[model samples]
Target: MFVLHIALQGCLRGGEVVFGLTADTGGHIRYLLDLVAASSQDVGVDRIVVATRLFHGAPGPDYAVPEERISDKVELVRLASASPAYRSKEAMHAEVESFARNLVAWIAAQPRPPDLIHAHYADAASVAGLVADRLGIPFVFTAHSLGRVKAAMLGPAAAGCPDLARRIAAEEAALARASLVIASSRDEAEVQYAGYAAYEPGRIRVLPPGSDLARFAAAEPRPQVDAAIDRFLHDPGKPTLLALARPVARKNLGALVRAYGESPELQARANLVLMAGTREDIDALDGDMAGTMREILVLIDCYDLYGRVAYPKTHRPEDVPAIYAHARARGGLFVNPALNEPFGLTLLEASAAGLPLVATDSGGPNDIVETCGNGLLVDPRAPEAIAAACLRILDEPGLYAACVAGGARAAAAYDWDRHAARYHTLLRALLAPEPPLATPRQLLVCDIDNTLVGCAAALGIFRRWRSRQAGLAFGVATGRSFHSAMAILEQQESPRPQVMITSVGSEIHHLDANGVTYTADAAWRARVSADWDRDGVRAALADLDGLVPQGSLEQRGHKLSYFGDAATAQAVRARLVRAGRRANVIHSHGRYLDVLPVAASKGTAVDHVRARYGLPERAVFVAGDSGNDVEMLRAQGHAIIVANYSDDLASQAGLTHSYVARASHARGIIEGVGHFRRMLADAG
Candidate 1:
């Protein structure tokens, strides 16, 4: 379909995320998803599409896994059972080619394709990258885990040999085509993506996924916070400390819990609050909550001071801010002791929530804590430092107040609205306006009745005439059907008009030689249909004796032209016009009284004829000599009114420039056409 985008109609204000999902699939996709989701929240993204397999951990419709829910604006497409696994070598290549073709078709079908595609991981990157190039669109890629970086970080999974080498090569190809490359952390970019010297440095921007501070500040406070802490802490008014992390070895929650057990102030009165197990509702990848809970229980038992610690596992995301707020009210401190943490969203969450944070100095927390002034930074590997920082937050009121004030000020600056606006700006910069597909505006209308062909005389000359004159473009606008009108056009002795407006006022057609067709409105023709005489005196003629239907509109174009000598045809016209009640009947063929529209006459017909030939509007000539010819005579003011015409018509026709034709009928028509052509050539 050829469609026109008339500027002002196509622009959007957000970016969209398209991703794949499954359970044990929290590889680089998770990192990309986290950043994008956070980025989207910070920026007001309008929509997201998640391409899902049959289930979380399965690949077909028959899988038993339950439906997965994400955001309200996100749509999920179930991948068919025929979909190939990403881990398969030969399958990956084939899938990329097939998916890219389908993806392009989908994009083209959209009302507007995305401005910039940001696909995560190598497989998705290559797929989107291929389309971006073909469609002349921009693409941004974020390689969270590259082979080299993975090899260094996760070891065996990163080694490039055979299948792994091929996978890494795909990542390299996609990155080379990326308009922009984003890295979660500088380390990942340097260790994973930087090895390619050809990668443009200016195109790579390091953007950490930012968190929303407003939501954190307004978060539903933990209602049970006071109750839980009161039942645990000895000195109720003294400051307390909070702990948060996943139950994994790298998270180092065990060290923090042990320190909380030994801290002097914590042991004396302050309560130790640990996120024992999140009521996050997100099913674990392993699906072993019982086993997970038992491990945390053992850690608590080892401390033996379990009475001073509180396990709040029924925590909802909504309660996060209140938890932070309650901790702030109680002068609580946030502690993170992860070993070699890449980037911790929890730390940013705590800072945004206005809780004075305490995190290890080695990784992302190093940037967050210091940049925001929301917390005390210490090396997590040093237990003494972790223990000491915990005691100061609990015991030093002056130092604790400064941290609280800093967190609040820092939280105020990280507005999600601002983040969304910047991302929106980047997307706009990335997109180009779609190519124009509409033609320039202009109108072409032609006469169908008398000019192109009236009965066989006019239509018969059409084909031979069109083939003779090539420069004059043709358009037929007549009160004729698409079926009959086209047949008449086809039978013409000339090439067909490119545009055919048939059924008169009903439809306008654009006919191309390529078998392409388009239909629209012939604006003027439609107006004529409503106002003109449709069931005219012509229809009534059927009831009259000797009056028969003739013209294309049945007794239209040729009118009731008298067949006998000129005097009789003239006498018949006088009788018809004399009976006029509203206006006098008109006759161009002499014997015919064409009850036409007030403005309609052969002059109108001639005007339409010149339009059909696209001659200058002022250019016209006629050869009829009766009342119907009065309009044409006046229109052509200096036209020939056949000598056989009555003196009454000659006077009304303003005979100033009249020519007494020595002949009439077809011979007069031939003379009129020849004279008009001569006048046009002379002017040229």
Candidate 2:
């Protein structure tokens, strides 16, 4: 499949990227390049075009080139925007309309339009969104760093910046328009994006970007790179505290300097090395980058930290790995005190180079440090916390050794090939003419816990049998939440389902074309929401005897769960009826009680799915084993009651026509399905 990547605010090109060359030219460029390179290796990916804005200015002549081939299947295509000069991310909004038009025109000229468009950052997403709308294509958004997150991190300082508001607006638009949002960490997906007006957790996926760290892992300290840093240090042999990032206030480099300067113990334990971008002249740098540099310098001088600190003016792109190696060789810690890091790519690189980290507790480092077990997380705003964390790692040899071993795991944990394969699968699903749910001739909805997964040997046989039925769409109608159901299915290595009716039919989620992510059914939610007063039902049944509220996980927006007996369930229904509130009260196993919307039940939900797919009653099959399954079993003509059924489900009213299988669990489901298919065959 052809994929187009749009990244409008960077000096994007192939080979030896000079990061820190432009304020906008940083980690996002590295991420995009690595992602595209990895994507090119996928057999399913036919062609990849990296689209960016063409400009001529200070960075270099390379940015002016309209097109440059990176590999056989990948090429960089730069489109001319309104302005020719380099534009920072803030300035990107002015050029969006022009870039979008040019991008669309460019695509129109291609041999075949790309199967999908992937937007990098907010500005690029805005441009891609417009291009997609015009071309009738779907685009996925990756907000490398969110404007709201940055604004929040900057706090009072962010208020002075007018462009930040516009950037946030563009991000909201991107979130609303994009088909999918790919996040690098749980922090990005859950916490950061949750603040947005267009936030939808269902559409946002956390797919960590893989880094090419082999070079860093095997890197040896070069004399040139070491000398650049060592010359500024009084004792070069001391463990180095390295902070490598663009010299921006958001990176919190000034805080790191203060942290190092305030503590004499930390100062003696490790030499501070600040590789804050390549600057020929500090004064020549623009805006925040220049101010940040001046602040670091002032802090260094204020605390009389001249001999102990190494703030290098410049280094080549190839020298990055060696810089990490230099720190690793000296038993140093890689520090990222960024106010908010979207994803800590440098943290991964440092770990791969055998340098343990002292990262900020704000963002992506939470996931990285947890996964790698290679570092300590400190509050970036607290200089004392930063100093203390550094001292702890430096003072303890055992902890240092543990971190080093953990650092070794980074290379395998974040791999590009694995990322590319998963990415390709998602794209392939997006390009599918129809989702698996849309065109299936028949659907088989089964209960998860008892009916589908109880017998491992029976499940294996069922899996093989299900795979052979080309026109059959399989799904689960579970009392469990979406996440809970998915967890069990994945653990059992069960066949991927096309539909999941979770939370006892209050929530419906359908599998996406990508086969990995699921989209919630809004129509079903709206249907169940009508006349359903959740708060009223709860208040009515609050003091009902023998009823106790279940834990938070069991409670859903449309479903209220309780640990109660059948008598309590009956009382709950009576209370709701007397209060004039409509709800469906379900009691199973003589113990668990679930209160759902009057329109929602396992049976009603099964009918909704059948009707949605335009399947006849004869074409829809449902199998269940207990009390909650009664509605579902009676709702369909092709119902299966497993031999290991509970709650007297087989003897339930209106279930007389339901098939009673001799076998149990998955074996029972298989037997009942065959019986129904034969009955249909005989009727025909």
Candidate 3:
């Protein structure tokens, strides 16, 4: 079987193809190259193509090659975009449309199109989605980091990425259309894809990327790596806390610096080593890395941490193992304090080297810590948390030994050979022609806030139920904007929804592996936009006693939000009605008041979604707790209200076919499902 792997950014060169030759070319490049090398050894795979974008100048003339053979079975295919000069991935979004066209033309001219296309990162996913669609081949996506997730973490102050909306929309579109999504961790599969409406939990497969075990094994110690660290450290014998990553905002390097600076115990015990980039001059650096470097320097000077912190701007790729070996030799640990990690490849590298770890309790670390059992997970945002985790490993000899052993054991499963074997099996299965399974006709539409999450036991039980029950579908309806809802859903690790009723039902989205496709209600948008004077409304409500504007994320195209008590909400609603505004005002959780287009409501959205999917009344179950969910709960014949529901929801006691559950949160959902199933069983 022929497989096409697409990675569209970074400087591409042949010969050595060293993974960490520079900070800009990180784990993803290593992941692609290693996978190709391993797959070349797999007998089932006939040929491998590593398709990438071409850049002009800088790295070397080697990048100008149209195609270069890496081995008898593997080759690199470089496709150029519209512009000549190289730019960061964020700047390359606009050129992707042309890139896709060029790639498709190139493929069409080939002897035969690839059997399957696997795109890595957002840009590659975008381009690959279009190419795969045009050629009628299955498309797979591996989003190393999600744009929506990043935007949520950084907010409006985010730098470098100006076109967040375009990126997010592209991701959603790619997700919706892709045949399969390769997630490096379970957190990525379940949490990151939560907001998209067409997300099928079944389509995602959790396949962790592998490390080069041969390079990082515990037995191989490099003197050069030790020498490199010795040159930077005030005392080479001190227990070190090493952090290796690009100086990006999301990596949270500044926070790690602060954590080290704040803790006297940490400083007294271990030195902090950051291998950030290849530039020694801070001012010479540019873009996100420069900003990170500037902040790190300020913290260093402010904390008087000179001689205590070592940040080397350059390192050879072969030096990475020696770097890990140096830390291990010093009885030190590796720390990854990224705001959110998609997957921690370096954690595996460090673990394989018998180095103990202290990483953030975010994304990949959760799985890595669990599988490795060699580290402590803490909140990367908190300096105290980061410091505490590092201190534990540094101070306790018994704990340190256990972590080393655990890491070696865990590292075995993550070798490139095992990773390639798994992929070989998965691909062979996917390539085999089989009868299509029946789609789930019955759907459970539920609200996210205070209903689906916050009850761990029930959520676990629900996840088990979803796994066993193949014919049932699930979706989420919330007042949250798409991004906000996704942030919440990601933490729950629940099933991916087939539909999302976001922004108080002002927006509808159909999700697929290709990306999210918006189901536009143009007439609804026009009706709301026609006479809606947002500035006037803000001015009119500015002086209200208890009301405040909702956060930027809460404000949507046809929705204006405020946080206020019931009295203020009533006053705002009455005032808006008296002013003859075409709005539907909803008060939920006694604090959130949303003013939306009169044409939109959770109930209306449910009807629209139900009609589109052609689901029957008996097959749909709607669940909620707050007032915003009341319309949807009442709209469906099969409805549920949890025991902890607000008084506003309880007041709807007269609604037909509505069941009040004895359990709260996800437990309530389980009880509600049981109630509906019994009714259906009786009727049948």
Q: How many clashing pairs per prediction, in order? A: 16, 1, 25
> TM per model?
0.47, 0.75, 0.64
- Report model 2's TM-score to 2 decimal places: 0.75
Per-residue alpha-carbon lDDT of candidate 1 for residues 230-273, written as tens digits (9 for 90 to 100): 66645556555777654544456667766766565556746677
For model 2, the superposed segments whose C-alpha errors exceed 4 Å read 156-160, 438-466, 469-496, 499-508, 512-517, 521-684
lDDT by residue for model 2 (31-126), tens:
999999999888878999999989897778998999999999999998898999988888889999999999989989989998899999989888
Judge candidate 2 against the unseen true structure and give its global Cα lDDT, from 0 to 1: 0.88
Instruction: Sort by TM-score, best first.
Output: 2, 3, 1
Write the residue-wise lDDT of candidate 3 on 1-684 in tens digits.
Answer: 889988876766545554333334666787788788888998778888888777667555777788999999899988888886666666768778888998898888878788888888878888887886687878778878887788879776655556776778778887887777777775676676766665655556677788776678744557766666677668778988999988878889999999999999999999999987567566655457778888998999999998888887677776788888878878889999999898998898898888888897768787778777889988888999999989988778899988988888765666677677766655665666322213657878888878888787888887888677667767788997665565356445666566767888877655543232223444445644666677666666778788888744356657889998889888987787677666778888888898877777887787777776687888888889888987788788989888778856876655656898999988898898899899889989
lDDT of each: 0.50, 0.88, 0.77
Show model 1 residue runs off by greater than 4 Å.
1-109, 121-123, 130-137, 143-177, 184-201, 225-238, 258-270, 276-296, 340-343, 432-684
lDDT of 1 at 41: 55
Cα error, residue 523 of model 3, in Å, equals 29
Clashing pairs in 2: 429-513
lDDT of 3: 0.77
RMSD of each: 30.9, 7.2, 9.5
